[model samples]
Target: MNDVSYSLKVFKQIGLLKPVAPHRLLGAGLQLAKWGPGLPSGVNAAAKRFPKQTAIIDDAGEITWSELAGQVNQLTQALKERGVEPGDSIAVLSRNHRYMIVAIVAVMQAGGRVLMLNTMASRSQLGELARREDASLVIVDQEFLEVAQDVDRSLVVLGWADDDAPDDLPSVASLMAGQPTSAHAKPSRHGQIIIFTSGTTGLPKGARREEPKDLKPLIAFFGAIPYRGNSTVVIAAPLFHSWGLINFAFGLSTAPTYVLRRKFSPQQVLQDVERYRAEVLVVVPLMMQRMIDLDPAVVEKADVSSLRITASSGSALAGDLANRYMDLFTDSVYNFYGATETGWVTIASPTDLREAPGTAGRPPFRTTVKILDPDGREVPQGETGVIHVGNDMPFGGYTDGNTKSFAEGLMHSGDVGYFDEDGRLFVSGRDDDMIVSGGENVFPRELEDALIDHPDITDVVVTGVPDQTFGQVLAAYVVVRDGASLSEDDVKQYAKTHVARFAVPGRLMFLDELPRNPTGKVMKRELPDFE
Candidate 1:
């Protein structure tokens, strides 16, 4: 058989080979018929298809598709009056809320690009982006409005005030009421979207992409999980991150009634999933770990039976966590592996986890992966090399001119990993993060995974700092499980038993928590230096 034959066979095995009924296809058409260049078309299409259906639910209340379209029109007209034009930037700083969604759609309708500011960013960083991006307007949540004070005075600032009664700052409700609802023309170019990196090591870089192009990548994703027009989705990930933004984009096309929360906790997440009967739960790996940490009695009380897909992405899902999630959720856990730069490279299903433990699974349809050494030679299976990928989901490069290295036709993932004999991908760590202690290369994940195997250790991070004798020895930072006691010697002894002598840490430190960015990535640069 040919490559296409093998891919189609796998798709059939994953249940994508099923036939679709005529009305369901019609329903999909109704939701996507008007989806032209801008994202507003998707919302308009949804409203036209199911005007009475619930579009979004938040702390404030729910809005129907028709009501959402009206508000989007109102904001769009108001933005037109304010002179928003094609290719202009509309910077946003807000938590997850109804008006934030309104602003995003409205700006695009008025032919402006969106710069989703990180609500977790400091005042200085927010100010810098607004000025640097040359934003024509800055939309702020009242809570984040203070951070916009130092931004360029020429930029127009609009505030989305929450119900606490702020007399100052114009509210989105007032702006929408000021304009008339009417159909708008398409922009000369499709409005682009910009998402920033987590900036764990340095300043966050912006990644911009053109309007939606291919459905193959999206279809490939849907093949791995059940995402459809009628499904309900609960987005626990932050809106500024790629995982959250992409899921939200999928919602726009599918017209799913989505549930969003301002803050995330294990109990809150479980409660929302139960209350809404959400069929899909999209989250980062840390959120799942917290959910797993919840009391068994509390977890038993929640009915997660409605969820068909619990997709984990944006970070590595450790093997132990995968087993724990599957043992509890019963094969619903699907782990996706990729970076913001490369899109999705691989996806691991419950069966894949059961067979190979920590594998990142195989490449999806139309996606290719190659493991190469420093000289760009193809490394044999089971030997670690830099992971590179090329897929239909094209990366349009970064806002900053600096680019990650590329070889052949594939973009470098900067990740170190190897492929098993069964063709499953195993990501070790970032190539830059690899440690060379006493001339023996070490990937911290190897030691960290071993350390976390201890019952008392809830989490562990290993970093390499400069050393005189061994030239950059390993230092361990640990988070002890609650009500658990641990000593440095105990940790070292446990490590010695689980790993090699050189992989053992030279020193150990305990912390209440590891410092992480918004995407739940550990900030090793922020860790204390023993040197």
Candidate 2:
């Protein structure tokens, strides 16, 4: 589609094309003009346009757009008063809640770079990352106070705290109290947002993303997802991850009522969806699986008919899982494939899931995806090669001054995939994950996808282990469903029918559960070796 038509379509999808009062439009424009296009600008615009609209509904209570904007302004002023300067790096560690949202926006308004720390990180990891990122200030939830305290920083603030918060430590609510609700002065520079890699194999590295120069990136995203403005969205994914963070930004534009929870509970999520009549549900595949695995009676009784979209990302959405979720939820599932370093590469819609299960679907508007051989040449269709992608918002490299492999103006996604005759992209596995066993190339994802479909298996992870004869052989770590007995021979027999002869796992290890990071990506490096 042409640029004009594409932009119009995206605007309409997000409800920006709807009629609005001239005065409110003018006010929103003025606010954006004053603060520029960061979170501060978005929040202020939303407040101006829909002051009475509900902005956030968390465990504490609901807050209107006007109230949220006021709190953000007050907290921004307080952060500046506490010596936060432009270009300063501030690390924030907290779960999904009003306090986390306010702290992030406040930091951005203060012109301090925001580093979103993983809530599941170890204390040592947190401290090391905070120091490495040169964070001048650390804001943490009450639960992570000790972890935040261990980090070396000039200032430590409580993002969320109880009434009995320490007298010495300042909380977001405390800072906002007795402060002016007016907008703060615009910072000299726009703060950058840094999201870390999942770090399944090693220590996480920070990926920096700057404010977009144009609406192209936004258009690319909105065009792919069906999100309407003025709707309620339940963000079940962790805010620290890129998927959740991007959806939050999307919410700022659409002015949707956000429903957040400190921790993810499958039952609570379903209850919230019914309570709020939420139109959108954002989650990772793991969370979706948990929700789908809930009691059949509970799933049937839940009133999720109001939901229009159930978006999944941050990890692979298994084909079987997607089919099962759709069968139960009536085809609202949308799977997004991308990495911290590469933005979104592909999005699988309901039709894509139904037509060709396991395919990553296709690229969205203004996105370029190609399968490249080792020589940096585009491979033939249906030929497996590394995936390379180019989008309007290219990653700004890593905070540590490193970058992903780039070729022909595209960044390497580090994944191997191919395009089918119908143009759907099917990711085989990580490039480094491909193993040569008995002189035949094997991708563990293909085997894992096959193994996960077993009736007795709840989860599975396949990896390569050294073998004296084959150089490296496949090892399957299987997690059987509760009360279900599964043996290695059973797994081998199942795989023999589902996969190629050589692809059958040579060794098997049964586990209660597979080790995974907070985002639900399997930690292959953490799998136990064969005895």
Candidate 3:
């Protein structure tokens, strides 16, 4: 098989499927026989091959491949009936649930580009994002109904409503019920999934990617990470973020038994892993920490031994967290470093983590990693600089024309890090997250890494809080372990021992938990003003 054809085959493996309809399965067979690069076509292949396999197990319900394909078909037709033409933008705002997955797949199946909206998006951000994009239709969940109240009712679709109440907004369930569960017209080409950045600095820009031209890099990633091909998988990360969405997309290609929980609860994740016998567990750093926070007895009893891979991304996976999780869960943690604009830059396996506790391992196949200084010159090994990624896969540039500058032939990653002597990449901090403390440039990660080792601390986010003396002084927001107690003086003294005095946070505040985006990145702007 050629690259594209092989890629189509990989797409067929997208999670597991089961029988729901014989005729529809036959149709799926026909669709696969005339396979294209579209995701629906992949789903069709899986529906035919794994007709009796379980596809999705979510809070909404369990579904066989037959049921999933039928739902996608129904929604595809419903969307077309609603005047959603191929290539039109369809936005989705919901948590991690079956309907959210359905809306995403159906939109693309209908040849519409799916724009995933962050569930935590504020009303103004939603309005602005919807208005700025070419989205004429938005599929929103009931929890965010109030946020989408102003959307044209004709273009609005309720994705997941708890009560299934009759309302002006058209319902996804109603559409699926009214439409037939079978194949629809072939989608226009599977357009890029437009994921928006967290936009901590400004408006979130869409990082679009065309259909991957080459499958080698992806294949290498699969080979490198212990994903346990074609096994039961549990994804706790929100699909809105790049890390989660990539896994979700890849899982669809592999057709595994996909278990999703709409909201994340530490204990519940362990339960799902045990119940589903999930071999591949995907999480963000925060979720991993939360899972570790569960009672030791509860964790020990939870049978997560089926897990072959516990991949994490979207934020720095602290060395302490990695070691603790590995100690508890048998060294299955894999940490990745990258951004929304650029795909995976590096992936650190358990061995890499064990060797260099926080190293973001070397690049996989067909990927180039470079750390360049302000002058665009490659920085010396082990010197902090902006990260740039060069992969054969085309980055479907931002929709708003705000693209990052390319160094040589690579896209700038906006992360400040350097490669280790052994060629492993390590991210120190974000390019813009640096602060000046007493005339010295300080990266929050310096202090964060220093404090993450403290047993009393659960999680920490260090940000630049303004100070008259230093222009920008360091501030830290910390979450303590259950029943742990520590004073400001205690933390300050501990900070003094680990990092330079200038890097020590001048202000420290304790909280039950830090404010984090769905992807687990701490929202620095949301940090409390303790001064």
Candidate 4:
């Protein structure tokens, strides 16, 4: 068998499908070595397979594998000349564009670490994160370069790969010229990428990738299946996120062509799909909603016939929205569920999505999941409890000193869910967000869903507040529809009939807009603490 097939066979034999049977399963004794050098590892292979095929497309331009390889060579030389050595952290802050791909390859090719800075971050926040990561170099576009002036790192100005730059900052294009194409280094799987979670949690902790063993499954599973060679993928989200990292790695593992946009615009998405003839698209629920909100003719006018699959992750896909998407697009819509701590643990296929709207689908093909009680004991199949996923199949653990996130052998997903008779997983809410009022346990999602059903409410969030008598009381923060006035009584009356009496929100506050993190997750902590 070939090397890849042999590696896959080894993975399967190690019980990639099931947990290690405590009584009989002994750990595999073989230690496998990854062959090949740094950025060239996958790029070299891709170039050989599809030298003339377009590998990346953006508003700026399109690049084939051969051209991409040459760009990587030139940029690597430029970065090396600027004193960026192997293992140095290269901070990248830019919207999704062609240069983003070029800088990433240049960093990895030079054996440097990539620290993706959130483009949506405030100037102060970006500076703080860059300082916290202690990045040695930063590459940014002309628009964001002003924000990086006080970042305390060397800067490389991009968006002008072909021009001569002033003072210290060098143009990205000038550096790529005249550089030798063969200089390369091998990247250790143990290398780290610090990806901040896209959730509403403030002061987000950077998730580290450490285990060499855990890295392969991410490559094998996501690489081969979701991201196959010669496929076209449309990425509308920011590339500095876990989703973006996964997209990059998938391209590296397999040689799929990718198209990126500076910012997500529903109309632009359709235009890119039609223009690039994209075969697959990965998006979050919010972006999909925006795309649906566009004129019906937008979908009809756009030629998305090349689209084969659309994977939605990062948030729940409402039943109504899912059906509407299927009706509008020819491609299948799948749901993916996982956290930064655990890479894509479960996936709901289009069939599963249609059969069960809110279900996050079955555990991934090579991962195992269990619903456990508060005490860590496995709950009955139908019981709602925290979901724990085991990482026996070359899975990486968190970087925190507390390795105890896993109990016995499972990684606690911090989510409340249960399995149905058909073994489909249904996530109800987050355990941390469950509001306990008086003696009743109230889940905010249930209340939020009920609130959104009201015509006046355009967006709503449910949170717990300290109450003198009830210990914790339920409160709802809402953003009303334009020109519509909604009173507290209206909220209460709507919730009372639609939701349980005890679950109805006691206090209602109206705001021009709901506070959300860059990824659109509601910031519950920012909500007023009421009694």
Candidate that scores best on lDDT: 2
Q: Ranking by lDDT, best first?
A: 2, 3, 1, 4
Strongest candidate by TM-score: 2
The 10 consecutive residues of candidate 3 with the worst lDDT sum are 11-20
Please list the C-alpha lDDT of all candidates, in the order they appear.
0.78, 0.88, 0.79, 0.68
lDDT of 3 by residue, 404-514 (tens): 789888888878898888999888888888987788989999899889889899888888888888888888888888888999999999999999989988888899988
User: Could you tell which candidate, 1 or 4, scores higher by lDDT?
Assistant: 1
On a 0 to 100 scale, what is the lDDT of residue 467 in model 4? 78
Runs of candidate 4 exceeding 4 Å displacement: 1-40, 153-168, 187-191, 210-228, 392-404, 453-457, 481-487, 525-531
Question: What would the per-residue lDDT of candidate 4 be over residues 205-245, giving only the tens digit for each residue?
Answer: 56765433444555435522354446778876567777655
- For all predictions, the C-alpha RMSD in Å is 3.2, 1.3, 3.8, 7.0
lDDT tens digits by residue: candidate 2, 1-531:
789998998888887777889898898888878876667778888998899999999999999999999999899888888889999999989899999999999999888999998887878888899889988988999888877667653478888898877888878889889999888877898878999998888888999986777668778787878899899999999999999998998668888999999989999999999999999999999998898789999999998999888988999876488888888876888889998889899998889988999989899988999999999999999999999999877688899998888999899999999999999999998999899999999988888899888878888888898899999999988999998997789899999999998899988999989988778998777888788
Clashing pairs in model 4, backbone N/Cα/C closer than 3 A: 38-185, 38-186, 161-172, 161-173, 214-394
Deviating ranges (above 4 Å) for candidate 2? 152-154
TM-score, cand. 3 = 0.91
**Model 1 agreement with the true structure over 1-531: per-residue lDDT tens digits:** 565665565445433344555564465455354445346766786676667889888878899988988998998888877788888999987777678888988888776889987777778888788777878888877777668778664464555565773555566778898576666776676677887777778777888755656456655676665575556788888777878877777556566888887778889888988998888888998888889889999999998888877888887775478888767765677888987778888888878888887788889877889999898888999999999998877787788766668887888998999999899999998898888889899877888878866888888888877778888778899999999999999999988998888889987899999987666788777887674
Model 2, position 381, has a per-residue lDDT of 97
Candidate order by decreasing TM-score:
2, 1, 3, 4
CA shift of 520, model 3, Å: 1.3
Give the worst 10-residue stretch by lDDT in candidate 2: 146-155
